[model samples]
Target: MDIIRIDDPRDPRVAAYLDIRERDLVGRHGRFVAEGKVVLDVLFSAGRFAVESVLVLENRLAGLESTLRKAAPALPVYVASGEIIDRIAGFHMHRGILAIGNRGAGQPAESLLATLPAGALVVVLVGIANHDNMGSIFRNAAAFGADAVLMDATCCDPLYRKAIRVSVGAALKVPFASFGDAGHITALLDRLGFGQFALSPRGETDIRDAQRTDRLALYLGTEGEGLPEALLSRLRTVRIAMAQGFDSLNVAAASAIALHHFSRGG
Candidate 1:
């Protein structure tokens, strides 16, 4: 890797990393920010996206020598002082690791879905815009070995810096694609030979009783509104049994329990 020293926060070479907290919200155009050492490891090994470049705090570079060695020789690695990095990122630099990952051209939802093997486990999300929930869901999906994650267009980006950080970088490891809407997704899942289940408090089958098929799609909804009545009415619904007065679990917890059941044949 080419080592470049960035002494000035306003250097054009690092424009992509400027005002990270603000730019993260407006968006980075085709790029996404990934923070922390763990996410940097995933960015290189997962092969889910191309890395643009890397910026490291001066003191932390030695500790990351092995990890940064995975980079292509031509990749630019910019090292800066902690104070300079803090100015560049517009925040404190406690983690001392950052990278710019290109989105690349995203694969279409149907194309991604078509590639799943028989007996694949998939998690489907609808209207889940909360970054924390999105991160936790990806973490659960990876933990349970779900083959992929699918979400409607209403969901948030898994690549958002905080979401990726919160996921402990699982968002980069898991293969995922977003669809236009719930109805289109339903049709696609059916046409693709998946037996789909909508998980909710009023589901008809207990998650334990729901049998896995050659391909399974587990649908989860937003935190507050939950799944729409129409979705619940048209699909096979499932519930996680809980003690009295509790009807549901946080989507992440529910996904863990439900995915564990399918993955381990509980």
Candidate 2:
């Protein structure tokens, strides 16, 4: 692998490489910058996305060239002086090696649903604004073998950098789609014949009490605010049994427990 040296931060070729820090502003196309050795390894092994380029600080990323050569020999790897990289990225240096890849294409909601096996379990999020919670939800959903994930328009992007890192790259593996409105989601699931259950701390029945159905869709809401009142009014509400001393769990933790319960035939 030939190391292409980059001395100027102003180089147009490295613009995408530097744009990673401002991923939120860059919108969908900027979903590619992966940091840390472990994350980079996961990104490369995923094979769902194409490698765009790689940037590294020579002194810090000594043997990474051989690693990249073994994993993606054909991709361009750029080596920059630490100072130049820092200037361009607007931050101090750590995790010397950064790799950029194209965002993998996601299947539409209807397409994903059509491919599901009978008795599928799906998790849906409505108006969840926190990226970390979104990522953790994806991680839990994957761990529990959820058939698919659906997000309402008000929710944060699951592929956002913070969400992706928080999910530990689980977002890359999970099948997910976004719906523009709750009414559309309800109607679509009804059309697909899915039994919809909304998870809320305050509910008439425990999640365990609900009969295990052939097709179940779990609806979760935002952190502090909980599920939107209007949406909750439209779906069956279910709660998790907890000790009398405790009233609630963090949305992510609650999701893990709930998903585990459903996965185990609850």
lDDT of 2 by residue, 40-86 (tens): 66566666677777788988567664457445676777889888888
TM-scores for candidates 1 onward, in order: 0.96, 0.84
Each candidate's lDDT (Cα)?
0.88, 0.78
Q: On residues 1-266, what C-alpha lDDT tens digit does candidate 1 reach at each position?
A: 98899999999999999999998789888999988888888778887888989999999989888878877778899999999999999999898899999998888788998889978888999998989989999988888889999888889999998899989899989999988877888888898888999999878998889998788889999767889998888789998888998665788888888888878442
- lDDT of residue 145 for candidate 2: 81
Please report the candidate that would top TM-score against the real structure: 1
Clashing pairs in 1: 119-214
Error of 1 at 4 (Å): 1.0
Q: By TM-score, how accurate is candidate 1?
A: 0.96
For candidate 2, report its TM-score. 0.84
